[model samples]
Target: MKTITLIRHAKSSWEYDVSDIDRPLSTRGENDANLLSKKFIEYSFAPDAIFSSPANRALTTCNIFIDNLNVSKKLLSVDEKLYDFGGHQVAKFINNLSDQYNKVMIFGHNHAFTAIANSCGSTYIDNVPTCGLVMIEFEVDYWADVKKGITKMTIFPRDLKD
Candidate 1:
C-alpha cells in the first residue's frame, strides 16, 4: 500500500514584521514539533521522502522534525505548489506525485492540509491544527490513483503533554 503523511506547518508568530510567507514559527510551535517527533519515533512512522512549502514556517517545522528523525537531507525537497493554502492546488500536487515515493511526508499550510485530509482520509477531521499530522494509506500502487484512502492515524500537539 502507498502511504502519504500530511503535516500542517506549526503555529506561526504574528509578532514578526515579516510577510506571511516569511513568518517563522512561534516558540510553542518549536516545542510542539519536538514533541511530535517523539511520537513519530514511537509509532515508527518514517517516510521515504519529505516535502515542504517554501514558506519559512513550514520549512522550519520540517527541519525540526527531520533533525529528530535522523533522516537524510537529500530526501527533503521544497515544492512551490505546497505553498498554496487552498486544498485544490495541493491535491493536484499530491495526485501528480512520483510513484517512486510510496511513503512520503508533506509539510504545508493549514486550509489545504485540513481540506486534503478530510477529502482523502476516511476520518472526518474538522480541523488539522497547527503541527497536526494525518496519515493516509491507499490501496493503489501508483500515487496517481490514490483516492479516499484509510486514515491510519491523526495526531496533534494537544494529544501530547506540554
Candidate 2:
C-alpha cells in the first residue's frame, strides 16, 4: 500500500512587492503552520518522503512541518514541477513518482492540490485552503499505477480555531 498526503501552502504575505514565487508567509501562516504540525503528529502523519514547491511560501510551510516532525532535510526536495497551479503538471509529476518512496507528502498550491485530491482520492474536496492537509491511500504497489484511492483524512486550520 502507498499513501500520499497533500498540504497546501500557508497564507502568504502580500505586504512585500515580490513575485508570486518569492512571497513569504504571513504572520498567520507561521502560527497556523505550527499548529498544523502538531496536528500532524496527533494524526500520525509520518511519510517516507516530503516534496515541496520551490516557491517561498510553500517551502516555508514544508520546512515548518519538517521541523515539527523531525524529518531529516535529506528526505525533503524542492521540485519546480510542484509549483504548478493548473493541476496537470503536478498531477503528472505525482503519477510518475519513483516506487522507492511508498509514503509521500507534497506541499504545494491549488487548484492543483484540490484537483489532485479530488481526482486521485475517492473523496471530493471543493477547495484546499491555506494550511490544509489531506491524506490519501492507494492500493497500488507502485505510484505509476496510481488511480483513485481512499481519502483517509483532511485537516484545515479553520477546524482548529477556538
Candidate 3:
C-alpha cells in the first residue's frame, strides 16, 4: 500500500515586509502546529519520508511535527516542487514519488493540498485548512500507479481546539 499524507502549512504572518516564501508562521500557527503534531502522534501514524516546501511557514510547520515526533532530521527534505499553490506541481510531485517509501508526508500550501486530498482521496474534503492533515492510502504498490484511495484520516487544528 502506498500512503500519502498531505499537510497544509500553518497560518503565516504578513506583518513582515517579505516575500511570500519568507513569511514566517504566526504565534497561533506555532501553537496549532504543536497541537496537531502531538495529536497525530497519538494516532501512531509515522511517515517513512517527509517532504516540505522551502517556504518558511511550511518548513517551520514540518519541523514542529519532526520535533514532536522525535523523527530524525535526515528523513526530512526540502522540495521546491511542494512550493506550488496551483496544485499541478504538487500533484506531479506526488505521482513521481519514489516507490521505496510507502508512507510519505508532504507539507505545503493550498488549494493544492485541498485539491490533492479531494482528487486522490476517497472522502470529500471541503478545504484543507492551515495545519490540516489528510492521509490517503492507495491499494496500488507503486506510487506512479496511485489513483483514488481511501481517506484514512484527517486532522485539523480547529478540531482540537478546546
Candidate 4:
C-alpha cells in the first residue's frame, strides 16, 4: 500500500514587494501553522519522506511542521516542481516518486493540491485551505499505479480554531 499526504502552504503576505515564490507567510499563517502542526502531532502519523515547494511560504510552513512534529530535517527536501499551481506537475511528481517510500508528505500551493486530492481521493473537497492537510491511502503497492484511493484523513486550520 502507498499513502500520500498533501499540505497547502499557509496564508502568504502580500505586503512585501517580493516575487510570489519569495513571499513569506502572514502572521495568521504562522499561528495556523503552529496550531495545525501541534494538533497533527497528536495523530502520530509519520511520513517516510517529506517534500516541499521551493517557495518561501511553503518551505516555511514545512519547517514549522517538521519542528513541531519532531520529524527529522533529513527527511525534508525542496523541489522546484512542487511550486506548480496546476495539478499536472504535482501529479507527475507524485507518480514518479521512488517506490521505496510508501508514505510521503508534500507541502505546496493550491489549486494543485486541491485538484490532486479531489482527483485521487474518494472524498470531494471544494478547496484545501491554507495549511490544510489531506491524506490519501491507495491499495496499490507502487506509486506509479496509484489512482483512486481512500481519503483517510483531513486536517484544516479552520476546524481547529476555537
Runs in model 2 lying further than 4 Å from the true structure: none
User: What's the best-to-worst order under TM-score?
Assistant: 4, 3, 2, 1
TM-score of each: 0.97, 0.98, 0.98, 0.99
Superior candidate under TM-score, 2 versus 4: 4
RMSD (CA, Å), candidate 1 to true, equals: 0.9
Candidate 2 lDDT over residue span 1-162, tens digit each: 899999999999999999999999999999999999888888766688999999999999999999998878899989999999989988888888989888999999999999999999888889999999999999999887888899999999999999
Q: Rank the candidates by lDDT, best first.
A: 4, 3, 2, 1
Candidate 4: list runs displaced more than 4 Å: none
* Alpha-carbon RMSD, each predicted model: 0.9, 0.8, 0.7, 0.6
In model 1, state the lDDT of residue 147: 80
| lDDT tens per residue, model 1, 17-132 | 99989999999999999999778877877688899999999999999988898888899999999998888888998889988888999999889998999899999999999999
Instruction: List the global CA lDDT of all models.
Output: 0.91, 0.93, 0.93, 0.95
Per residue, candidate 4 scores C-alpha lDDT tens digits across 1-162 of: 999989999999999999999999999999999999999898898899999999999999999999999999999989999999999999999999999999999999999999999999999999999999999999998889988999999999989987
**How displaced is residue 103 in candidate 4, in Å?**
0.8
Q: In model 1, what lDDT does residue 71 have?
A: 85
**Residues 52-148 of candidate 3: C-alpha lDDT, one tens digit per residue:** 9999999999999999988989999999999998899998998899989999989999999999999999989999999999999999988889879
| Sliding window of 10 residues with minimal summed lDDT for model 3 | 39-48
Clashing pairs in 2: none
lDDT assessment of candidate 1: 0.91
Candidate 4 TM-score to native: 0.99
- lDDT (C-alpha) at residue 142 in model 2: 86
